[model samples]
Target chain A: MPMLDLISSTGVAPNDVEPALFDAAVNQDIDALHLPNDADLSDYLDALPRVKSIFVDFPAFTDGRGFSLARLLRHRHGYEGLLVADGQLIPDQFAFALQCGFDAVRVKRSERERHTAEAWQAALDAFDVTYQRGYAVKAGPATSIFDARLTAAEANKTTDPFSA
Target chain B: MYRYDEFDAEFVNARVAQFRDQVERRLDGRLSEAEFRPLRLMNGLYLQLHAYMLRVAVPYGTLRSEQLRMLAHLADKYDKGYGHVTTRQNMQFNWPVLGDVPDMLADLASVEMHAIQTSGNCIRNVTCDPYAGAAADEIEDPRPLAELLRQWSMLHPEFSFLPRKFKIAVTGAPTHDRAMVRAHDIGIEVVRGPSGEVGYHIIVGGGLGRTPIIGETLRAFCPKDELLPYLDATMRVYNRFGRRDNKYKARIKILVRETGIEEFRFLVDEEFKALDASDIMVSQAERDRIAAYFAPPEYASDIKALDLEAQPEAFRKWVETNVHTHVQPGYAIVNISLKDPERAPGDITAEQMRAVADLADKHSFGEIRTTHQQNMVLAHVRQDELRAVWDGLVAAQLEDANINLIGDIICCPGMDFCALATARSIPVAQKIAERFNDHARQQAIGEMQIKISGCINACGHHHVGHIGILGLEKAGVEFYQVTLGGDATQTARVGDRTGKGLSEAELIDGIERIVDRYMDVREGNERFLDTYQRLGAETFKEALYADA
Candidate 1:
């Protein structure tokens, strides 16, 4: 086991890893590019269509720049290919990373054995509810409790509006 | 008295289960301490100097009698039989074993309460005017909107890991701003447009920390329905652009300051327009549904009036000092002071909690409210039952009768409890309270907010105090810096720091010197802050160091 692990919602392992350097990737026509945590996504927005995978680095798990970058890549640039979250990610934050539009996570080699595929699966299902919108969940984007309550309240309306 | 729905109940329980698992793993060596710290913090568990402190959220300061009883229960069962009320209208139990936290959370969940988002670098417990629904000057109750935000910001995916903790405060009354909205990250004042459409006047970037700054108005009149969308956009902008490199400059205020409010507003507006507003917005009907939960409890209009003549002098003083006017006639709001002598300010014992719960049930329609100044309020008490309520409070040692007075001080859990504190605040506050113990003198001093913070974090909100005392460590020795003329009202301003820091021994003497000068310079019953405003901080600064 190389411990070069990539976990996705579909449980499929990633293929043909590419170098992380931007100029090298551009010169070599690499399909995948792992950008540092501080990388500006707009600079590479045009190349997103051509690229198959974009792994945003999380230098520190607490530093959430990767969340913004992932969202920008997906929502702003419309990068539909696999978006990977790389480095220093805790298993608990997997859902947040995924919700921010990352399709996969490249677990560090040392911790790969402990963070198994089943563990990642369990981590995703840790919480059944989210209040945020624009998240990419397995069952498609989930509507918040407020929206659900509104729908229920609208359907159950039976009398004069202000009588109660 | 907004009861939790099935959704809220389930959400909290699920969070408890998740935290329980996280805690178990941490204990079993499966999860590292680093990984577990954030999880524990998000659940409102902090590793304090002595033991684990668990902070419980009292959403918008609204608590039912049952909830209060449950808090009392937790205090007796797990803690040291008392809980300290925080400035943000939450309660903190000083000692809880890490293993028992999950159980405590489960207990909290049973009461439709959990510590989720209470201590994390996320949207914390939304605070509002404690007298929100009952205030005579209130345009509308702000608690409903505050609750809506509480739901929206709970476990928000992107905002859960913010650069710094964010706070949001709402107020319905413009004249009597008890929430201190200007001192929060997001200050929402309920407003009505010229065409008679109700909405919010949003203020962004205002906060109190090492660098205290008042929030600037982002939108003068944001349509009521557009609030959620606008807030979503604003938070998104802050999460993406807020500085993370420096911990001290991580608040949205710094970003707003550095990038300029106008540019920050533009960025937020651009994001607001670009994001699909429909995806984030709740319908007016949904808003109405939430509002209906906070509707006024059934009232009995006919009630006996207070016998002003028959009351004792102490009772009369208590009525004048501790009671507030309510929107509904014959109803009065009674403030239960936690700043008693020889006790830590804002600490209520388990017995006192149960007593207050009993008082709520008997006099205030089984409801209680927590004020930002760390006092409890019986917001719907009948005026005729004032004497009875006073008697009950007196029996429980809760009738301090010094709210908004000199003795009723706001003191943070300083070096005594808080790990971040450089000097002790409780003793300084106690000494000040002792110095101004005379009822007549305190009444004469009039409405003055004396806030004390342990460190530059400003948890005691010393920036906006009428008289602020900041405790800082000077070469391993405790020292206090004084400030004057800070106001937390519509005309919000940070206090000006006086010259020189005083030693712990000189703190009380220095304050006395300042107060004596205030007494000497005062004319026509001017408050301390008013006198300071007229005479300026320079006079106080000179008087303070005159004897040094």
Candidate 2:
């Protein structure tokens, strides 16, 4: 099973998919993944699908994109799958990665695993909702009648609607 | 004042509820700080230097007596008993805790006021002429149009996440009291067409910042009916093409500069077609309804007599200094100078707000105005009731008659309050006002503007004064630089820096030298600006250093 069918400018885009940027997103099977170095992990939530996941290459330890994307995919994206933090999965980001949402994290079975998992669990117990856009579904649009009226928009006002 | 209809009430109530839930979620560790910053900013709540600061849009700076009283109440209960009137024509409370902001917003919502989009990188509170409807020489009252823009721009989905904040100001007054028709992201001024029909001469990219620009004329005559769609189209264009990557080069003004006004105009026109397809006819009609709500209040037909010669010496001085003529018969514009002796300019206590509100209800229309000069204005007052209102104002410590004169200054809350400021503006303004509080001497000196800023970010409007002082820090010691003859009017221009910066002590000495030079060379009764213009900066510059 792979959420890898989804390709986006911001996320772990399938290398096999041909793509322009900004206005384009495509669905394809994931063989190899390429996460843009400069892309902010914030917009990557839109790239995650409910089904499958992929192995993210962490080019460097200082480059924390792999960890940030891992957390978003797991905790924020609610994707339950393997996230291999290859390349330079430094000791520190591994803990933060696990705290964010990464469940099955890859850091070569090393002496640091026991120490890192404790820190990750400790971090995970601290909070929730680590995003600007709401991830959890609320029952309805959060608003009221009066706010709705003022924001009733340009098309709704009988008089100058913009006067609100 | 536009009263909150049922629709408005419901919206605010719902927003409050939603925010309450958001707070709960945060407390329960369901939300993180970064996730919640934009949400809070959208609601007009900012985590400032210390506590939260809530800025409410006083759209066009007009307030009903009741609304002013409500603000007073909010100040008394939640803040340090006063509000700071910002240069952008919004009021800010600097010391509210995060938890209290929701309730403060609720109180504002009761009066059809809310802090929405007052902060975020979105369309900001629309500003207009303080005298709007009452001012002479207006093609039309600009407040209605301002209100219309406030409604139209709020929470615009596409434009909400702009690269930076946007400001729009409007003025119907040919004199440009609103500072409209200047460099803003969008500046609008009402103009008379060939048939005497009212049209708008829209200007775009006018602003005050690191790279200030005088707005270029975007359209010569935008007919009244097409104004809304044109504005919509303009925003759409900006939303689409405006820079988002680099915050510094994000304001529409910068884009306009980079692309050139002619190309920007073409892009805007193309976007305007898209807006036409949306066809917001209902909203256009809604403008009429909102306009109706703001129609001039019916007044007394009998004109009350104002005896110009029956004034005492002090009364004459006050009258000559503070009062302005009104378009309505026997009515006058009463200025409640916020810059009282030794008081922080523009700071009004909660008690003072209530007092002004009461005065407005009795002597003027039940309305109060917060001028761009950091003072409150009683826009429509009967001539006969002037004495009574003045007495009340005097008791409240707001009766200083220094409007547009020395010491009636515009000063930013510099290093003392604003984290962004480099030096203290309050001290500079206070010292200057103290030096010239002698009423007879000030009257002799005649009309002059002495503005101060804590930093180059001229929040105190130091750039547009007859005598401008910008406070800076030189090796941790406060220093001030002077700029003369900068006007913030139809012909807005930033003053050139005069000489090198001087220490705080020498700053006043320098100001005195310049003033003395004006007295010696000025033609009789010519104002400071007139003298400075006629004599040139070189003359003023020579005087400043002559006695140094």
Candidate 3:
């Protein structure tokens, strides 16, 4: 298995730390935590300070609960530790995962062979811009298209004519 | 009517290129069918029972003449020679080959139209009142807000892959909800604050399927600037806590029902307070810019009303049913009925599409709107020029005086084309239309909505029909269930089940008996839904099951 660093847009070796389940990690003295998509974030708030890395399971790429979990962990709980997405996800989801506060994705060896590293890198550069804000993109924070348009209008100080 | 600026055009073109690459990947075996299904669905290409179905979004049900012509071109060149208007105010081509969908999307993009987010688990196309700007009772035009939401929700990163599909509808009129706002996941009503500033009243968790629930008000009023953040917070909450174990219970309605609206609002408020929405909010200038596109067209002040006495009796009847009063003084809003009894409801031929485009160009400032009732509206026609418009429609075989009559049915492409359907809905709709083919009788029935869906998914919106019909497969045989008193207006409610299901042989007769019973028990000038509300479902149930 390999880990794809979406922020750096490169494939790297996976970390050797074995993450324990939420119960085990909280009860024992483990520093790494593994959470399911449906795991309650409030339950782990106390244990998050000591946790070094949190691995959120994406049972399938289409299952998007992991993205929300990543957002909650990053924005709501202020978890500054390494958050890794572990399971089956396509190259198309790499950009979304990166924007949703994921640090890296643990890809299965077979899945990597099928999709290839270059495909993942290309998927990252597929869209140069986005429509929503409050996301951590490679270029600092994401600026919404609406804000960009308003900035352009301010710089020009003139209205653009409507053309259909 | 909002035009794409450079950014919008570039984004749509880029998406078309991405889809083109994905299609190539699928064709060359780089992607499996399972992996390719969601990607294709996000771009609005569905593999149906017969062939591929491509749903092209008509954003907020508004279109330019050139856009409509481009749709006709796609129908002629890539698909079967016609298209189907869906219940959500989008267009669906029934028989397009899988290989040609990318080219079709490219064509759509050329005319500022694309099918992005028309399907998949993303926020589907944002719909609004078809008469948004032209309605006489509109407090504000809803299209600008609908357009803003459309752009905001397009290819959204965090909310794209939700538990299930999401829908949003908006209405500008306080008294009438032609947009069917309460039947969506998030229903927004344009409202005025005490200081005369415009805000939105947000309703969340309304939906129809196997389980139908009318949405409850999530926020009494959301300030215009905070709308995006509020919606973002709502989506975040639903994406995080909405049920995923059961596919059937994955909608936001189920989450709202399970968590209750009060708790859901609390969670949303917590999320909303944390969101930094300065960059996401629409500026007043930007809103004004969008609103300018929907401004009323210049009307001819010298235009005079048509003389009804000189026109034929048929034309007078058509005027009575199809023409609605426009806010502009000398202009009228005309509905072009797609429900000719000989054809399936909402199906329009390529030639008819071109004719509509021509009519729009000549009479309605080149603007057209697709209604949620599966009809097209020429939003601005001069009173004197209506006869000319009617002549063109008659020539195109599109002049069916059945705007809100019983003949104007809303039906989904059921077993004939859809893979998920249990029985055929189009033929059933056509048979009912034929049974009541008499124009005078249909007019006498008066403003009746008979919605039919082939399965529990309720694509036909059977749950909101005045007379609802749901078709199910029982022991490999098709049976239909009738529901009564569903309303889709401001006072929206899900229809109640009458009793047991009826066979195909007994369905039409049963419906006729119900209508006959309503006629027998009705007071002066009351519609079918009004009569049903006054008498209740018990009366209709007795009429339906007495012989059995």
TM-score of chain B of each: 0.99, 0.95, 0.99
Q: What TM-score does structure 1 among the candidates reach?
A: 0.94
- Rank the candidate models, highest TM-score first: 3, 1, 2
| CAPRI tier of model 2 | incorrect
Per-candidate TM equals 0.94, 0.79, 0.95
Which of candidates 1 and 3 reaches a greater DockQ? 3
Residue A48 in candidate 3 has what lDDT?
A: 75
The local distance difference test score of model 1 is 0.85
For model 1, residues A58-159, the per-residue Cα lDDT tens digits are 877787778877776777667798788888887788888888788767776667566666666667777666666556365322446766676677777767
- lDDT by residue (tens digit), candidate 1, B1-548: 67777777777887888898888879888778888888899889999999999999999999999999999999999998999999999999999999999999999988888898889788999999999899989888998899889977888777788888999999999777899999899999998888987789999889888999999999999988899889988887888888988989999999999999899999999888877676567777777878988889888888988888888999999999999998898999999999996898899999999999999999999999999999999999999999999999999999998999988899999999999999999999999999999999888778879999999999999999998999999788989998888998888999999878999778788787888888889989898888888878888887788778
Candidate 3 lDDT over B370-475, as tens digits, reads 9999999999999999999999999999989999999999998889999999988999999999999999999888999999999999999999999999999978
> On residues B1-548, what C-alpha lDDT tens digit does candidate 2 reach at each position?
67766655664566666666566655665545654676677777877657778888787888888888889999989999999877776788889887777788788877878887777777888888888777777878888888777766654433555557888889988565555458578888989988988889898997766565777899989888788668766775676567766767888988899999999999888667633323333244566767877787776668768776886676777888889888788788888888886778888889999999999999777899887788889888888888888889888988888888887888888887877788888988888888888988788888888888998767777877788888888778888889898777787876767888887778877788888888888998999888877878998898777656
* DockQ comparison, 2 vs 3, better candidate: 3
Q: For candidate 2, give the lDDT of residue A31.
A: 40
Candidate 3 CAPRI assessment class: medium
**Predicted complex 2: DockQ:** 0.05
The DockQ of each candidate is 0.48, 0.05, 0.53
Lowest lDDT 10-residue stretch of candidate 2 chain A: A129-138
> Candidate 2, residue B150: CA error in Å?
1.0
